[model samples]
Target chain A: MNGKYWVPAVISVALMLGACGSTKERNPAGGTVPTQTSEPYTDRIAPAPAPVDGSYDAAAAAERALSTNIIYFDFDDSTIKPEYQGVIDAFASYLNANPTARVRLEGHADERGTREYNVGLGERRANAVQSALLAKGVSAQQISVISYGEERPADPGHDEAAWAKNRRVQIIRQ
Target chain B: MKSIRYWTALLLLAAFPAAHAELEITVTGGAEAPLPIAIVPFSQVPDVQLDIAQVVENDLVRSGRFRALPRRDMLQRPNTPAQVDAATWRAQGIDNVVVGQVARSDTGYFARFFLIDSISGQQIMGYDVPARSIDQMRYVAHQIADLIYEKLLGQPGYFNTKIAYVSATGLSHQRTFQLIVADSDGENPRVVATSREPLMSPAWSPDRKQLAYVGYERGRSAVYLHTLATGEVKRLVSERGINGSPVFSPDGRYLALTLSFENNPDIYIIDLRSGTRRRLTDHYGIDTEPAWSPDGTKIAFTSDRGGQPQIYEIGIEGGDPRRLTFQGRQNLRPSYSPDGRSLVLVNLEGGRYRIGLLDLATGDMRLLSDGPLDESPSFAPGGAVVIYATQGARGAELATVSVDGRVRQSLRQASGDVREPAWSPLIR
Candidate 1:
């Protein structure tokens, strides 16, 4: 059993080292190094750390893991982009680790379509994120979704930049 | 994008009082040649509150049909038939002359007016309107305008009608919303509902006494019925998921709305008397924005079952829906005309949304608005013009255009975005 687990563990460590080295070169302007080294290193030798009561706040964990809270989409599309996968993965992991964690996904859309139809599009975007979390082993009870559509726009302008910013899903801890 | 902030600041300066923001109207397009008329200022007693003649003149001028002659150009200020000099008005090329007066009565103020045909010097019509209070003078002025409109233009007048819309303020997170009711001319605005959460989709009942709208009071969407007379609100529907896009049937017996409790947004109708809901569409894709036909036999809605949003019609008894639009890339938010012969909807073409009028009998669609983003197309009581929400320099504003696309007018609020305009039926 030890040998079977060691092979995959070694491969994961090698991948992490490669990722860490590339990130350092790409962002060499005094940016702090990615600080998620505790999990992989400890999982290889010791049992997983038990979740602490009252200390595991899903919101703080999310803030530390991701640089931004907004996940954007293409025009009239709700599919999650590959660039946002890491952010979502971090959130899903945090949710799975803490059984009491709960989140509300507020979805929105650009003001290009009709209001009612945009409401439907916004809901679809939020549900897309919810499905991703569910597939990552997060319980349905931990997630609730609401769509504001184009009603509450982050940037209230009539241009491409504003439209891009408005079409996003914001994850809020409950 | 920088211009938006500047425009917003300018609008904020003009916005105040929180409860009511009188909209300023700008007429962009109208008849090629407006019929010139003279609306002499009404002579009033000391106690009367409002400028009744000015209100009447503004209504006729905004209608895009009649042009009131400048008071400076008028040769005389006539308040009765005896003071009228028809030859002088005809010499100035005026077609009609309006004269009026407001005097005090035992109960309240009384107004008498007359419309004269300039060529014949004959009184075409006249009335003695009584006002119960000073505040009702504006409404009395609108009634006089409606009478003149119907007499000269040969069509039903919509001047005395009311409009319901949603007004929003504040930034993204700290937003406040209000459902407001105002006159068609953007006067006498009253806040019917206010919430920290989002409020949208205000639909008036047939009697014009109740409004059905979607509110997020419980952290999730639910439909609420608000009685205008009593200021009473009751939650009509609150399921697990979305409850939005509430529209009343013609007879006020049912409400068609969109519900997503089963994880799919579909059209559902609730019997107002029985409180029973019946699902209208079972499609996996979205089906929302239900509009009842004038006869209450069919319902028009927006659906994406065909891969893109388009208008579809389904019978009230429930059956297969027939697609009503195929030309636009996407079509939604359909509202039936008062005559039930056509529909006005938001059509997406070339990535820009505009209001389009689709005639059911001829299958011909006419683009009625020139704005890039126009939505919530609702027909006026007379079906001669459509009022819709459009994006302006300062944010969303209300605009109206004739069905022939000739006359256009924009209603601009001082602050916040005013949207989802629903024109009420002619008040009894």
Candidate 2:
């Protein structure tokens, strides 16, 4: 099937969502502007100043970023929040540096709306991460995505606190 | 049109024995003036195990259409039409009476019941149904109830139908998901398929012989078709992205499903015999949960094309979608009523998700459930009630409400999260 027939429409839609995403990024009064962009994400995962064995530990740096494997999302929104950019940068850098390493992005949503629609939302969230990694020059073959929708939730509670945690994309190393 | 199924070239797996899960039901509200009737306990041989009259009474009462006269109020229990005391029933304010008996036969057991119009003192109808074994007696009870329901209500009964749903047990990583099939009342639960990953979106085939569901394996998701009688499983589709929301066409010739194979979710139809597929919706926004019209010429699905999720209907040949719901802030999962007069859906109103019905002719919607979180509404075969999943005290459980927004019921399992309920069409 020529899925490209709808590319023009998809791009316009993506542009609209992108605009919304940036609008959501603006801080309201009294809200703290996240310091994610103030510091280089790599610096947080930089190698140790002086290793006991005098050897560089690349895995340690990657581990710092990979440790927070889950990227959370706003309610009913698949656009990646600025705060999760650090986690995405670490995974992207690691995947780009090691083309052989594979990862499966498991996307999830809160128990809201219908189940099947959440599956689509989950896929969109995973695809967002996939697009981020591709932008960092990671091989597409090293990444796969699956949407668990509302089936798998990080927190099984019904409140907003749980919903915030449930709306996430988990990066699982394979 | 209904397609006839031939059992040729099918695989049978005898190992999938049925496992039972107890479902507790609580009914509330009823018809304004329910038909007053009496269901006398069926005379039966020893060791029948189930009370046939009680099951029938429960079914009628659950419909909110009949108020069964309690046995304690009856002067006598009649085992046949000839034995029914019409004058006594009339005095009891019961216009109709049901009488039946079960007896052992050379092959197995036979149950017969008669419906007598107490006012006229005449037999209206009667049926003799055979049960090959004791275990089949419950099913026979449901069949008898269906017969009585249709005879009295002038429509097909869903009492004899089955309900397919996804049940999740355990917690967190230890969670186990099962695709279960149970009687309409949520009894006789059988695990059609089980997985450690996750199972969702279980849909019943038109003929009621198979179920299509989404299951995950090895961290990847796929759609599967499961043959109930045979326990044989077939992986229907597993595209690169989301492969889910599979629903059978009314004629069973094709399946309308949601696929994100092109990197975005959209509705697609797959030809079962040829394995060829054609895209139905090319929306950039999510277009999923496709439900077929009873005649199979149109499909109604949930979409976010207008910024908020709403139900949309499109022709099978692919065309501009028409939005069908605007009353709610959001609506998803569009399941059509059997008569095609209305669509039962999950409507989001006042920040709460509830089951709502949209009248196709009047273009009006009304809430059917009072909910903080209620979803996945499916209509019964006769379109009398809508079954949906709601968050209960323990976890998610199944519940039902009459189409008129009167009767309500909660079908809860002893343990586990039961959801994604799809009511089967009447098999016969």
Highest DockQ model number: 2
Q: For chain B alone, what TM-score does every candidate structure achieve against the true structure?
A: 0.93, 0.95
Could you tell me how far off, in angstroms, the CA of residue B294 lies in candidate 1 after the best superposition?
1.7
- lDDT tens per residue, model 1, A75-124: 88989999998878988887887889898899899999888888888999
lDDT (CA) for every model shown?
0.85, 0.86
In angstroms, give how far residue B85 of model 2 lies from its true place: 1.8
Q: By lDDT, who's the top model here?
A: 2
What is the clash count for each candidate, in the order shown? 0, 0
TM-score of each prediction: 0.84, 0.88
Show model 1 residue runs off by greater than 4 Å.
Answer: A1-63, A66-69, B1-20
lDDT of 2 by residue, B1-428 (tens): 12223211212223555756767889999989989999999999997979999999998898888999988888999898889889999998998999999989888998999999999999989988999899989988899889888888897778988888888898898988878888888788887777777788999888999899887766667888887876667888978888899999998989999999896899999999999999999989999999999988899999999999999999999889999998979999999999999999999988899999999999999899988799999899988889999999988999999888899899888889899899998876
Give the per-residue lDDT digits (tens) of candidate 1, residues B1-428. Answer: 43232221111212223365877788877777878989999999877768888888988888788888999998899999778989999999998999999988899988899999999999999999989899888888998998888899888888888899988887777777888888889888888877777788999999999988888754588888877776556778978667899999999999999999888899999999999999999998889999999999999999999999999999999999999998889999999998999999998998778999999988789899875999999899889899999998898899999888888899888998889999998876
- Each model's DockQ score: 0.47, 0.59
What overall lDDT, based on C-alpha atoms, would model 1 receive against the true structure? 0.85
